[model samples]
Target: MPPAIREGSLVFPKVPVLQAAGPLGLCQMVETSILNILGYATLVATNAARHRLAAGWKKKLFEFGARRAQGPDGALTASRYAYLGGFDGTSNVQAAYRHEIPLAGTMAHAFVSSFASFESLKPATSLLGPSFPNAVLAARDSVFKLWHEKNFSQMAKEGELAAFTAYAMTFPDGFLALVDTYNTLSSGIPNFLAVALALFQEGHTPQGIRIDSGDLAYLSREARQQFKECEEAFNFPFSALHIVVSNDLNEAAISALNDEGHEADVFGIGTNVVTCQSQPALGMVYKLVELEGKPCMKLSEDVEKTSLPTAKAAYRLYNKAGIPAIDLIQSASMPPPVCGRQLFCKDLYDDKKRCFFIPKAVEELLVLLIKDGKLLQPLESIEVCRRRCITQLQHFRADHLRLHCPTEYKPTAYATAEVFPHCRHFPEWRKRENCAKQTRKCVHQTLTRNRGEEITYTSQATTNALPFKRIEGSAVACCCRSGETCEPPATRIPTTSERCAGNQTQKPGLAVPHRAMCAACECGQCMPHSRISSVRRGISKNAGTPYPRVRACRSECRNSATMTIGSLIRHAHRRR
Candidate 1:
């Protein structure tokens, strides 16, 4: 699947995203660990991508959540994945060291408050060791020249200026001061500029300043305006200085800043990105879908909880504009869908809803990542993954990626009735079991009378009592009881009630109700009892049916060959 695939996009459900076809014990042992790792990694990466989208493509985004993360390990993971999701850098030093991610940060309030006055800068030394005193005098003279104010010492807080001066002496080329330690407009900006101008005189360029409190948008604008004033007055490049913002910022906050028209060049995000406060958990589960070469299914009264059966393949269908239109899942054995050929697609849970379209291009989503317990290729670098994510997002339609009233990207997961006709009836049979108490009895009686060839009847209340329809006009004969007539295949189904009545058994000169007679015709049941039992056993084991109907069928039925009781009882559990 594409890295930027949005939420609600069906990511090949019923198909294995990571298949472990090995010894059963080995597969079972690794399930929990794999789920745990993939779940959180995917969650943080997606959250970071959303933040990137909200912050826009041009702005720099840094991960500043190490202290706020769950633990040291979580902080490392968040930093790595956040960078992979398009963040520019991280404040976590260990993450930057380990992953080679660019490091970004600024001074704290403690650093500013620790400085008392000009005397506090006495211990600070610059790169110009012997000429440090002369450099400081030159820097102060340059600041005075820029502002043309002789009383520059009284213009801002002495401690703040001392702090900025000390930091500049330490990292003159990479100094990014935290300006909100005292007063943003009144003292912080002015003190930062005085030290920045001093750094300029010492032949080193200052990086930027950060605002950690107050109205960020307004403060950034005012700070930028102040920098521009100094740039015009002194004929320096002060207007180009960066304006970084921090203090519990999030995606919405960045967007709001954009809306309010601010000069913020970088965002230092922390708790929200690392902790995933908007959605704390990613609901990814590990389930066995195939074992011993047989398909497995988990049925649930809640349709969404029902697992898809079999090993399958997923294909993303793109329209002519190179935008993805639909994601289609099919059994692994089926050939890949071809472009320019009309294909039928059905909704995962809805039987009545369907569509047909010819794709301009089709991309097989599943790839062989590992073979013979060895990786097929080297893992992608964080930068490569980041680029892939950003590029993939751009291919999607704008409306589908929007935050509000976004159009849903349609996905289809269908078990073609042509290949698995019995599977097509599973949903209908499950619904029948829920709607009628007598469905099990009906199935038992039909199985007994028909000798397990096929089901001969179904309740009219559970299904539409339409006349029997053929599967794509195929010549295959329907399974019927002895002396019962089988209608010839028809291209169009006859809707007349007489056709359903004629297919049913009736007494001479006796009147029979239309619905009751319609129930007697074996319209859609063609798969043998053995095939149905295979499907039933797979579903019954995991579906959590409340009743003992399955156990009863196993004990009571003398002819094990003619079992049909498992069909209706497979999904008898209540909705969860």
Candidate 2:
């Protein structure tokens, strides 16, 4: 998925984003390391993109979080990903050099405090007087002329002025100062105007000023007003100077500033971008979904915990306006969705919520990154990725990207009875059985096993007893007693005898003996006789297999729990 895309818009409940098709040992060895690298890199990149959305596209955003990052490597990674996520530049010199990102920053407060008084300017003045005396003298005279009528010189600090003057003299064309060391409006802005007017007189343009503390919105506006006054009074273009603000800014803070109407042209972000203060960790896990050409699934009592079975493909459907309407997941072998065609889409977890969509465009999101353990193409550069992020965001609706009460970008899976006939629409509670049936269908369709081969169909069973097998040419249906409806596998509760049988662990890689009926011994370990008798009659008539003797167990089945025969088989396979 694109980094600019919102979360929850493209969910893969049972879908796999990364697939490993090599030896099991090699796949297991790389799982943890792969997940760790992908997780944090994605988290910080997404966080930076959110900041960019809040700051707006016209405003400049710089990553100033090297000091707040985890370490040197963390800092480098944050810088690279942040720029790729839409930031314009970074303050980390090393990151800018290594990644070829533009570098942007301003003087710190310490630089302002280093100058004590006018005496401190002697060294800089002696060094620079011969080179540019006329420009310095003109700027000082213009500032003194304003003090006579407005009396602004008394309130301004001489040390800060000396610092600004020295800095302007050293780098007149790129002089951007930090203006909140003493007083932003009363002293800092006034002193900066003096040096700015001097630089203007010398035919050099000063960059701007940065406000690091206090109410940024109000300060920026006031500073802009001061610049306007100087521009009109001195007859220079001081009003055009940029106003950069930085002080623990994040998405929320930037959005608030936008609401309050700030005069800021650039935003310097730090802690929130690098540390991911709002959400420190993204929950990305590694799980096996296929092994030896068989579909694998993880089942849990919580429906959300159940993983989707087998290899799948994801597609993004777009409406007429080119805005993404739905993300569709289907069997990898299924043909891709086509434009101008109405397709049936159902909610992955909710059967009641269904819709028919005719998309203007269909995009296949999963592409082949590696083939035969080698790269299929050269890796994309950071510049290309950053441009892609920006371009894609332009197509989404404004409401979806807003900070508050954003409209939801709905996601629907493309699994219908038409595609997978056995997968009839079912409620959330019955999804386990539906998923099991779908898994069997996926395996059959993908593997294409030969005739006479048996495929095990396991429902929620109490013990590791004989698993129901589907013969190549016959159907395996559940049998119920006369006038008694067969229960759905998910809701069926294990009987006391069945639970007791389940407690006895079976040997690894060995199938437990089939029991047509539990032994009627002193322990009273058995299922209801009616159901057992019905199943025995059904299996014997359909498969023509004789029933085996029942196994007697000593323990009592006092605990009742919900479990699937598929889960039992998985456990036994793991033990092997």
Candidate 3:
């Protein structure tokens, strides 16, 4: 069964995010592997979501964590899940291509710093000076001279510009400069602008500047101020330039930057995005909730560690305002919530706590993703999952979405009479008070009735006890015919010769079960009551009338030779 869908629904810990159902051991082998995969995937996705939320709706968040990821495969997993958690794009090319996610990246710092000096451009340096004069060749000599004159930091800045000029020559259409090699504000930005202005004048628009070091919040503000000043002075569109920040940024750091008034347009998240540094594992668990038709439970000293025992379904209850108000959990076999009916909810751990809501809308969150070991639906697209994350966030109130001190969301058990009967704990709550009263009354009656009896209690009392010794003797023996004495006129075991002769005289169709013979009769035809109890094991209740009626024996014996085939078979076995 597919569960209802609801946006901004808090379903985890309220109900299982994934459920497996089958016979007692049908899915036993796959539980651990399933939980591990789900646990890691959920953790990364949640981490990505926090970053997206922290970045705000307008700003873009990109996954640049391939190299920092656990492995190449892990990198792919991160990129896919990050997109689902609302990231705009990813740096992993394979992930982008496979998942249809937008691919994003530009020149790295090493790419920009690769060029040393323009003089090293060879014998063609002077020949090409006029053609690329202002952007590359014109400043090469002066920049190299400063590099030889000033500190190593200044030399590094010159190299950055030298490389940027080369890259501009290569790809003039998109010119995003990495401006933090030596110093973001000092030499990097200045050299970048000098080359960028030359590009702008030549009818090319510079894309943006990237900051890879320093206090990102402070650097972004400084870079934006410079860009604004240049736009006014140089009379070009500098304001349109994007300020990309790609330091050690995580969700918390992003939120902090936002709070402190950063001017960043895009965030390139790496280690923290893919690794989920703060909470690396989701700790998801797969437990056996049911065995065949019976409910199963695992006890733990920590109540939170305990698992809910039985098949279950989950629901989302919306308030009158159409905002999700509570998550309701129910037995899978229980009837679903009906429209216009008041649905009662109980706390998962607390029996006394209860609440009721007449929902404006009801939604089930689980769908039959798999059926009988086969997938029931195609996997949702990355775009669809990403949009779903955003849509779900929008349905919740702002208080719950806060990055710090967020409002907590909890799930409640569905507890109407029908729902309650299905819940083992809910019904017990109703019976507790009555049970206590009845127990007290019974205790009082027991004490009152036994008040005068001299009672002795001992550990060995049961072991030393006798079976009705005070009243026991022998049950009075009754005659099978006259109800007088059980003693017969002659009591003697028949010899083998006589036994064989008796067997020979039995009815032809008789074939007795080996152990069903009676112990009380030597004549081969005794009442069923005279047979040992084990003789009746093979006898079905409908196995015809018990010991079919027999004609009176010649000597009025308890066992007669003219008994029915069943009786004769049972009797021959007795003689054997």
Best by TM-score: 1
Report the lDDT of model 2 for residue 208: 95
Clashing residue pairs for model 1: none
Rank list by TM-score: 1, 2, 3
Estimate TM-scores for all models. Answer: 0.72, 0.70, 0.68
Tens digits of per-residue lDDT, candidate 1, 30-66, equal: 9889888777777788888788888888899999999
Segments of candidate 1 deviating more than 4 angstroms: 1-16, 122-125, 128-155, 417-576
Highest lDDT scorer:
2
Worst 10 residues of 1 by lDDT: 442-451
Ranking by lDDT: 2, 1, 3
Measured by C-alpha RMSD in angstroms, how accurate is candidate 3? Answer: 23.6
The digit string of per-residue lDDT tens for model 3 on 14-125 reads 4767777665465788787877777677777778878877888899888999999999889998998888787889989999998898988777877756666644332233
C-alpha lDDT values of all predictions: 0.65, 0.65, 0.62
Clash pairs (backbone) in predicted model 3: 2-366, 2-367, 3-364, 3-365, 3-366, 3-367, 4-364, 4-365, 525-559
Cα error, candidate 3, residue 345 (Å): 0.7
